[model samples]
Target: MLKPILIQINPLDNVAIVVNDHGLEKQTVIEEYQLTLVDDVPQGHKVLLKALKKDEAIIRYGEIIGYANADLEAGRWVNESVTRMPEAPELDKLELATRPAQPLESLTGFTFKGYKNKDGSVGTKNILGITTSVNCVEGIVDYVVKIIERELLSKYPNVDGVVGLNHLYGCGVAIDAPAAIVPIRTIHNLALNPNFGGEIMVVSLGCEKMQPERLLNMTAENKRIALADEDIIQLQDERHHGFESMVAHILTVAEQHLEKLNQRQRETVDASHLVVGMQCGGSDAFSGVTSNPAVGFATDLIVRCGGTVMFSEVTEVRDGIHLLTPRAANEDVAKDLIREMQWYDDYLTAGKVDRSANTTPGNKKGGLNNIVEKAMGSIAKSGTSSIVEVLSPGQRPSKKGLIFAATPSSDFICGTQQMASGITVQVFTTGRGTPYGLAAVPVIKMASRNNIANRWYDLIDISAGDIAVGKKTIEDVGWELFEMILRVASGEQQTWSDRWGIHNSLAVFNPAPVT
Candidate 1:
């Protein structure tokens, strides 16, 4: 028999998560009987409450997670439990019930000095981005950015910076394929993003799968085409003269746009205009208990204020989908969640890979025993909001409510996609920690533990460990986080990632090729 250790989550939950590191090492006293140990278990893991038949449902958080693969004994550890059953929360005592529509209040009239675009979108920075359609032209884009940094930017006070958003996959994939569509949409979205001025300098090799014209069409209203007749004519003239002449010509043109971009400033906008992306990296056990819930509360506050909150990484949503599905705007949205889950399953199966292989070695060391537990913790960052829409990777939410974007669980990839989808700000929760930033968006790092925050104060924007110490409530931390978000959006604050120059990157969803 296993020794019973009291672990409580909620009053209604039937089973307590096993905190014992070696629950299956030997027979120990548990709740009911002197049961013999069945299998080895890890800490921050779960074990069965009773015997479960093959294909029987496994329940946690009082909801079905997945079904059993084989018969489970009372003392057996449930390894990667998979339950198909769906359980709904009791309406009377719901923690986050769908309440009646309340009149929303805007954030106290405060605004950041930012660029106002022709399309009514606001930009936190005025940047001149040189985007390429394929890796073949990445060098050229980089060269252009370097030239801008060296010559043009020195004269322009208004321009934030110049950058080349490069990626590996743009060709050798089917046109409009899932892989191709993501990058194409991402480039288009980047061009339309409010942070950049009306002018964009597009560089293409002319034969990539993601054509530059596709990007141009998306931002038809305000766009500047390069590598065309006039630009080619200019390039030819500069080459004939000398390299210095070419550099000078580029700088002169860039200065014009920089002057125009700098003229814009931030103005007060309603909170409804804000869209925030929730992300986590280097997560630990404390992630779910502290920073994640704190961010979740902020998520709820944003949604209540008629703003949008986006949670991507479909893989991380596996265990929490049940908890989230009930809050979907309708059955279709819930079905979309199911469809995405199935797609990931099929993707792994078709590739002849174990789906559970997605869990990182670091996760296991940090007290995350399996994907279910990690996912449960990851989804807590969304709080309790109705999923108003489901978006493919790189696609923006059409309606204003909580959204789920289908993306890979890798932090850089997920963060990149979130920014590409037009989220101007990101709240990255970490327990272990990573220094990551996006090209165009600002990331605010929130540490889950006090020790981590103290040790890496340079990289952490907020320490949410106060919740664990009972010094602050989740609501209090959330309001503080919301204020930080505003400050970041308004250009008043800088993230640790930004200070350290950690602009790690990944493109929108591009699936691995099936051999």
Candidate 2:
């Protein structure tokens, strides 16, 4: 039995969030807040604790999320319609590196079993990745993949699985544009991900703008072999007489990569070898109150253990830009953070839209008032580590720590960028519910409420709902997630997403011109 509870995120906040889905009854006693409700508060929604004039700022997480659209009194429902977005902070005026995080003394001695690559990176899954230069040969790749799974994969017992890096950016677009680097580099990097065990194979459609050689690392021999020509199987090759020929050619090449991956074995590695990407989607008010904060705790634990963690989604963090700058590792990092923020701002402006447009109808119904409120919660997935590094979209990390990889708020696109940056595992927190996953990595889904957990028991991997129900503390759930990452990383456990093979397609962020 659970009672409708009010959650005050910050003492300075003028609003409190409803914790239970059914909401509280009018005049019901809330023992924690020491106040009775004047009206029924819906689950995950906010309740105003004080009167505000039009234009007065609405504070949550101890920062301004928005301004009042009209005068409102205490006990009123402060929904999205009544709050107007405030102007984003000027980039030049943000403070830099004010809250340098102290070294963690609590989490030490943490490690996970992973495969060590020749390039010095570590991988959680030993997989054979098949890369493609265009979408034209997708059906052929899918058909070949099914055959490989049914006929060839059984022989290579050590290889986890095979994934085809199918995406929409290879052809039918302006390939020579300055922004073309975004997709080209993205596909190139996706093949080089640690999980592939350094074996690269490509299937080219013969005449696509993105050639197989272009998607590989260039050698200085005047020849355009990226991964290696011998490893590439072009569909238009003169030797391929028919579709079956192409399929036969692909299977032969795949068997070779599988042999290499099958020989690699998991070994104990320092947590430093682990790079993780964290994101939130289908969010609700309890997302910040429960799952995100608990993820923050787990993030801190990972950082303290000498691991690298990436938190992203530019629009989700733009409203709380001021809070992030001061905690950046240095002035350069703070400025870099501002650059991504400004880029996203201009991007939206170019489209005649703004940050407020990011909040979906599902978001508003789930109790989030606006993007600002969402930002305050979304940024929580980063935990309290100093922003050690900042990266542009499609870039991989040169050093380890807490990195903020700039990416769009779209779940699939962000996950794709995270994979590009070398994250072998992902922890996705959801409130309204989403089945987002990536073929390049194992994603551990954390639900924000018990009701959602109970309803989608098989789909969700872990439940942060206990934090909201007060059955478990944030530390309890955080440690649980941390341990789960190791088990899934070590191949000892499989996430529901992995079991169901529910991977979403790669969505490379193309902010530049498409024509």
Candidate 3:
């Protein structure tokens, strides 16, 4: 017998989640609650603790997750179909920072081996990134990247890789739209990300609205580079007579960057330079019970070391906005968070959708009934640390500690923007499983259950599943995650996602209109 186990996220919660897959059956005995099952319940689904009348609110995590649409018996299943979404919190009335951040025991003197950048930032990997001003050049860029990796990369022992930044922006769009600032700043900041070693090499089609010079912002000295102005490579230049000439030009410039990258070696630095991004997808009920909580613990450790940790995906956390405000670092940070929420609300309204539209079939199948339940699980990645800063899409952080970067809940878009914000590493949690990674950064994937991990053991870098079965404490797996972050950040270990070369293309968060 599996003891008919279930988990209660909060003492005030009237519902509990079944932890065992296919473990609940008719006449099940919940010895812990002394309650007999009235109906068959599947694993990862909700089980009511007591009877509820029609139109009563459903509480989870001590918050109104939803309201019952029909009367339900005690110990009966309460899933999405029978629940109605609760009214969203009013942004204006949300409270400001009222609780001081929980202090952790002193975490003195932790370090990782990294390559220091000219701007005083650091990188876990040394790579040569090739930027493009338009998608018309992507085919050639990919060809060049393959050739470089197959041939030139082998020659330079120290250079980790050469990744081509291929994106679908820069053409057929109103470049002056108020929202255009998002994509422009994204491309600009990505070029300066510390992992690229400050070597800006851009390839352009020469006639697109986004000129190479504009993308590179060449007018002002990029004070961050501290290097001589470099020449841009334009494919349409008269000097480049044919395709071979263009390839040769790129190869020559790439070798120069590879040579420079190979010269840089890793040195031990304190954890303060780390900019880490945290996210979750394909999440199940156990996401809150296992992986997210463990990640949160690691988040606290990173924050204590004076490092930065970003937890993004606005829609995924929108339902929990009321809880987040009091954790903001100050009144200004709280207001900024509200402003982002309002902006996103307006954006959704413009598209005739609401936060409820965020849930996916997979989310429902994985035991997350709706966005409200999903948000409850998603925000746990922040731990109990104060949200020290708030960033709009494509904006880099000016301070450290936990940050809330407002981005779409889409995994690809969120990951791309987080990379643009200068995160050197990302820890992704999934209950249903996803192999998402970024060419510009390292991604660590953790599974919430052992069955999923065992099936995709080769893909998942870490497993926090044991927390659900009482085999491991959240602290045990959390400290493991903290150590893994350092090792991965130091380039001593390669994430499974990195090793497999599994990556999603850049999906820029462009709200600008197409011309």
Candidate 4:
């Protein structure tokens, strides 16, 4: 028989979540708490510990997640329909640097095999990236990509793969607006990603607002890339006569980059060279108790080893900004964190919505009550490290430690932005389940429940589910993740997503106008 279990995160929490694989029925008793279920609660759903009058605060994680909408009885199910979300924390009144984080013990003597670049960046994969200046070239680029994978990739065994940086923001848009900087810089930085090995190439239509010169100039101005005119292939140039000519030109240029990439080999590098990005999607209530916390533990391990770690998703962190501001390393970083939060606040306001729109139906079905409840779980991926730096979308970090990269909550846009910021590997957590991956980097997928892990045996890379049932401690799974990251970074092991060839397309975050 399955053991009846209830997990209360904090002593002050007034509700507890069911932990059994199959939820307990009415009249079922949890001997530890000596409470009976008044209603049939599904697995991962919360149950009230005590009856409450209308408008009473509901607490979890020792923080007020919501208020009861009606007079709730003891042992009844508590979910989105019965909870009213609280207001977001005020940015201007937030405390800064109140409780700075102490330094963790140093972790040394750890290293991985990585490809080093002249710009001092290290890459976990060796790839040849063909950048596009306009969406007009996508079809051609897609056609050429298949040809490269089919005919060219086998010849260069050292080159991991070839990818075309495709997006929809090159034409029919306001190119000179201030907000345009976001998408423009994103494209420029995508080409400079460490995995591309300093070999920059671009495909441009003969006529477009975002010309190759303008696009590549951004990188040159930032001192990121230096390329000659030969590096760009202009389809409408007089040299190209027909469709065959363009395909031949692209293939020839691709071979040149591939040959250069093939010459590079992995060398021993310090673990500090690793730059990891952490994110979560399709979350359920178990997210906070299991997978996310385990990832947090690993985040601390990475920071201790002198590596760089980033956690992003602006709306997901907005509600919990107060808890984070105090952990900032200094006043400047704290202010920067607030600046990003404020920017997102205004952006959401302009769209006539608020952070409450962040919660998906899947999230509610998986047991989350509102955005307030979801934000608390989402921020756990950052671990407890002090915020050493804050980065705008697509901006790389100068200091090494935990960083908050301001980005939208969409999974594809977040992954793209993190890649633009120079992440060579990513750790993703999910409870409701998603098959998300990025082609430029290897993503390590983790499941928050045993049932999902058991069902998606081949898809999930790690299972933090055991932490919920007392089979393992957070430290145990955390240490396991740390070791796995090293192996994956060294190219000694392949994540399931990489092995199965599952990858999502790049989705750039464009808050700018499209006129």
Per-candidate clash tally: 14, 2, 0, 0
Whole-model lDDT per candidate: 0.68, 0.86, 0.87, 0.92
Candidate of highest TM-score: 4
Q: Model 4: per-residue lDDT, tens digit, 1-515?
A: 78799999999999999998888899888888778888899999999998889999999988899999999998899988889899999999999988879998989999999999988999999999999999999999989999999999999999999999999989898999898888988998999889999998899997999988788777433544567778899999999999889989999999999999999999999999999999999999999999999999999999999999999999999989999999999999999999999999999999999999999999988889898889999999999989999999988788999999999999999999999988999999999888899998999999999899889988899999999999999999999988889999889999999999999999988899998
Report the lDDT tens digits of candidate 1 across residue range 280-318.
888865677678889998887788777778998777786
Better of 1 and 3 by TM-score: 3
Q: How close is candidate 3 to the true structure, as a TM-score?
A: 0.97
Range of the 10 consecutive residues with the lowest summed lDDT in candidate 2: 217-226
TM-score of each: 0.79, 0.96, 0.97, 0.98
Task: Please give the TM-score that candidate 2 achieves against the real structure.
Answer: 0.96
lDDT computed for candidate 1: 0.68
Q: Please give the lDDT score at residue 449 for candidate 2.
A: 92
Best by lDDT: 4
Q: What C-alpha lDDT, on a 0 to 100 scale, does residue 380 get in candidate 3?
A: 92
Regions of model 4 farther than 4 Å from truth? 219-221
Instruction: Write candidate 2's Cα lDDT for 208-248 as tens digits.
Output: 88887667753332123345566888898899998889998
